[model samples]
Target: MFFASDNSGPVHPRIMEALMEANQGHAMAYGADALMDEVRARIRDIFEAPEAAVYLVATGTAANALALATLAQPWQTVFCSPVAHIHEDECNAPEFYTGGAKLTLVGDTDRISAEALRAAIEAEETRGVHGPQRGPVSLTSVTERGTVYGLDELRAVTAVARDYGLPVHLDGARFANALAALDCSPAEMTWKAGIDAVSFGGTKNGCMGVEAVIFFDPAHAWEFELRRKRGAHLFSKHRYLSAQMAGYLRDGLWLDMARQANANCARLVAGLRAAGMEFLHDPQANMAFPILPLRTHRRLHEAGAAYHLWNGTLDGDDPDQPIAARLVCDWSISSDEIDCFLNLLRA
Candidate 1:
């Protein structure tokens, strides 16, 4: 039973086959390959933004940081939740890419409320030239806490950004999973809801390593390209990246994989709830943050279960003390594995 991370999962077989097929021919370097053209077209069609500009990078960090750098100025501060991936997980890549733009934690919780965001934005730019100006608002769907912001919540937050005349960026590292959970279209979840840019992820879904940086306005395209190149994220053998994305988008495979992953998480959550387990966060998307006893954790670990303890370690002496664990579901995790994990926990 492996639930460490979606990143640990194998690339889907179809994606591997696409890579193999792409290996047969020489393609243009630096994202000019025919596969890139297909990918761009497919993404634009999916998002219903015919004029949108889509570009690929090998990592989610590159996609998010570069996109933010393109949107916000160095003198400004990005507004986000304290637990946002950009704030917590990226290790200041956004700050580095934006050339020293600071991150302002909007709320104590993972989900930023509209009121909190407005107050944070207003609190900034009040200090004049001596302090950081207000920058783009960055929101993460499928937040690190394993909770998702509903469509209305997304719109509410983005509307707050629009009120301040600031741009908005979405850190969509689990874009597909969130999409699958919400049952919403790409456009509805993004630009239509006031998102200026997006880090459309594929690696966490089923692709090897590829994330697309999409700008609905398309005006950020040139700046993003320059930033990506300057950041040294440009791959010479770029077709490989293109091929992965093309394969991921093919035949709605991205949605299918995300649905499977979410289903797995739901099943895991259901089983845990049935056993009267308490949870840190409501299981949502492809992640379930359940609070388990330390003794149960040690037993699961000993039984060959793989997952990360969120708030507490397994070495503690208190057997009945509750600590949180982060269980992430990959598209490939079988139902048997979930049941096996549940059984181990029960035992």
Candidate 2:
């Protein structure tokens, strides 16, 4: 059973097939491929933003960093939660891409609140030229802790940013998972909620390595294209990325894969609960952070189950002590694997 990360999962057969089909003939390079046009059209249709500017990158960092750089100026600071992926996981790529823009951490938890965001934004740009100016507000759906920001919560936070004339960016590294959990339409969760841009994830769900950066307003398109090219994220063999995304968008496979992953996490959560494990945070999507007995941790490790030990260790002296672990469910994970993992816990 592999639960270390959704990134570890195999690519969907449809995506691989699409890649093979795309390789059969020569295509235009540098985002000029015919498949890319189809991908862009499909994304615009899905998001209901016919005017949206869509571009692909091989990594989520590129998608987020370039998108943020498009919205933020070097003299400004981005507002985000303390545990946002842009803050904790991106290795300051946003800062690099924006030419030294800083990230101002907003809430104490993984999800930011409207009041906290307002306070953070207000606290910035207070010192005039001495301090950083207010920039974009970045929100992470299916936040690092796996909790999703509800529609109203998103609206409130975006409204706060809007009050200060700051643009909004969404780090949707698990967009499909969050979408399935929220049961909201793509448009409702994003532009309608006042999001200016989004990093529409594909890798973590099932595709090989394709992420889309979508801007609801086409005004940012040229700048983003220039930034992407300057940042070296512009893929030369562009059809491969286009094929992966196109296959993902077709037949509603993206949502179906996400639904399976979320269902797997729910099953894992149920089994963990039955085993008397305590959750550090709610399992809102496809990730879970559970605190279980140290002995159980040893048992799972010895049984060849792969996952992240979030806290403590297997070799600690206190066998009965609880340790935190992160379990991620992917679309390909089978129910039998889940049962086998649960059995290991019971053992």
Candidate 3:
């Protein structure tokens, strides 16, 4: 059983088949491919933003960094939660892409409150030109802690940003998973919630490596294109990227995959609860942070299950001591795997 990360899962067969089909014939380069046109049209229709500008990149980092760079200035600062992927996981890519802009972490928790965001923004620029000016506000839907921001929470944070006329960017690396968990429309979770742009994730769902950066207003389109190229994220073989996204959008495959993933996680969570495992955070989507006895951890590890240990170690002194683990479920993870993992934990 592999629960290390959604990124570790295999690409869907449909996506791979689409890639093979796309490779059969040569198409235009640099996002000029016919498939890219279809992908863009599909994304626009899905998001219900007829004027949205959508572009695909190979990595979530590129999607988020380039999108943020388009919305931020060099001397500005991006506000986000301390647990945001852009803050904790991106390793300064956002700062690099924004040309020295800083990240102002909003709150101590995974979910940033509207009051905290307002305070953070207000606290900035007090040093005049010597301090970083407030730039765009970035929100992660399925936050790093695996808890999702509800529709009201999302709107609250975005409303605070909008009050100051700052643009909002959503790091949607788990976009579909969050959408499925919340039962919200793409538009309702994003533009309708005051998000200016989104890093619409596909890699963690089922694509090999494709993420789309969607700008609602389209005014930032040219700037994003330039930033993408300058950041060395532009692919010469752009058709491959387009093909992955096209297949992801085709016939509602993206939603189906997300539903499967969330269902798998739900099953896992239910099983863990039955086994008396304590959760560090609520299992909102496809990711879970559960705390279990170290003996159970060793039992699973020795059984050839792979997952991340969030705290403590396998060889620690007390077998009964609790340790947290980060478990992720992808579309391909079956009910059998979840049951096997739970059985192993009980054993």
Candidate 4:
């Protein structure tokens, strides 16, 4: 049972077929391909933003970093959760890409509350030109803890940023998963709720390493294009990225995959619950964090079950010590695989 990460899943057949088709003949280079035009138009229709600016990159880091670099200045600080991917997992790419713009972590948890966000933003710029000025409020839906931000929760935090006239960015690495959980349209979850830019992800859901950076306001397009090119994220042969995204959006395959992954996660959560697993956060999308006993963890590890242990090592003395672990379900994981995991847990 492979529950290590959605990023470890295989690409969907449709996405692979799209890539094969894209390899048929010669095409233009560096975003000039016809496939890219279709991908852009499709995203605009999906998001209901006719005037939005769309660009593609191979990794979520590139998408987030380049987009943020375009939105934020070097002398500012971005507000985000303490466990946000941009802050914890990105190896300071956002900082480097934004030209030394630092992150001011808001709440201590993965989810940032509006009250905490307001306090964080207010706490910045207190010293005259000494402290970093508040730049953008970056929120991660389907937070790192396997929890999703409700629509109201998203709006509350975005509204706080609005109060201070700061822009908002969504680190939507799990954007499709969040949409499946929330059952909301792209517009409702984003621009309508005051999000300025989003890194619309596809790699984790079904595609073969492709993410789109979308700016609801088209004015940021030129600056972003320059930043992407400067950051070495601009692909010389960009049609492959275009094909993966096009296939992902084709016939709403992206949503279908997301729904399946979310359903798989729900099943996994139910099975974990039946096994008396204590959860760190409610499973909302394709991720779950459960506290497993050290003995149980050792058993699962030896049995070839793959997952990340979030807390404590298996070498500890106590066999019954609770150790948290992260389990992720991708669109490709079968129900049988999930059952196998639960069976192992029960054993």
Candidate No. with top lDDT: 2
lDDT of candidates 1 onward, in order: 0.93, 0.94, 0.93, 0.93
Question: What's the number of clashes in each of the models?
Answer: 0, 0, 0, 0
Name the 10 consecutive residues with the lowest summed lDDT in model 4: 128-137
**After superposition, which runs of candidate 2 have C-alpha atoms over 4 Å from their true positions?**
none
| Stretches > 4 Å off in candidate 1 | none
lDDT of 3 by residue, 8-78 (tens): 99999999999999998788899999999999999999999999999999999989989999999999999
lDDT of 4 at 43: 93
Q: Which ten residues in a row have the lowest lDDT in candidate 2?
A: 119-128
> Against the true structure, what is each candidate's TM-score?
0.99, 0.99, 0.99, 0.99
Error of 1 at 259 (Å): 0.2
Put down candidate 2 lDDT per residue, 1-347, tens digits, no spaces. 99999999999999999999999969999989999999999999999999999999999999999999999999999998888888888898999999999999997999899999988887887897999999999999899999999999999999998999999999998999999999999999999999999999999999999999999999999999999999999989999999999999999999999999999999999999998888999999999999988888898999999999997877799898988999999999999999999998997
Reference-based TM-score, model 4 = 0.99
Per-residue alpha-carbon lDDT of candidate 1 for residues 1-347, written as tens digits (9 for 90 to 100): 99999999999999999999999968989998999999999999999999999999999999999999999999999999998888888889999999999999998998999999988888888878999999999989888887888989989998888888999998999989989889989999999888889999999999999999999998888998899999999999999999999999999999999999999999999999999998887888899888899999999999999999998898898899899998999999999999999998888
State the lDDT at 149 in candidate 2: 93
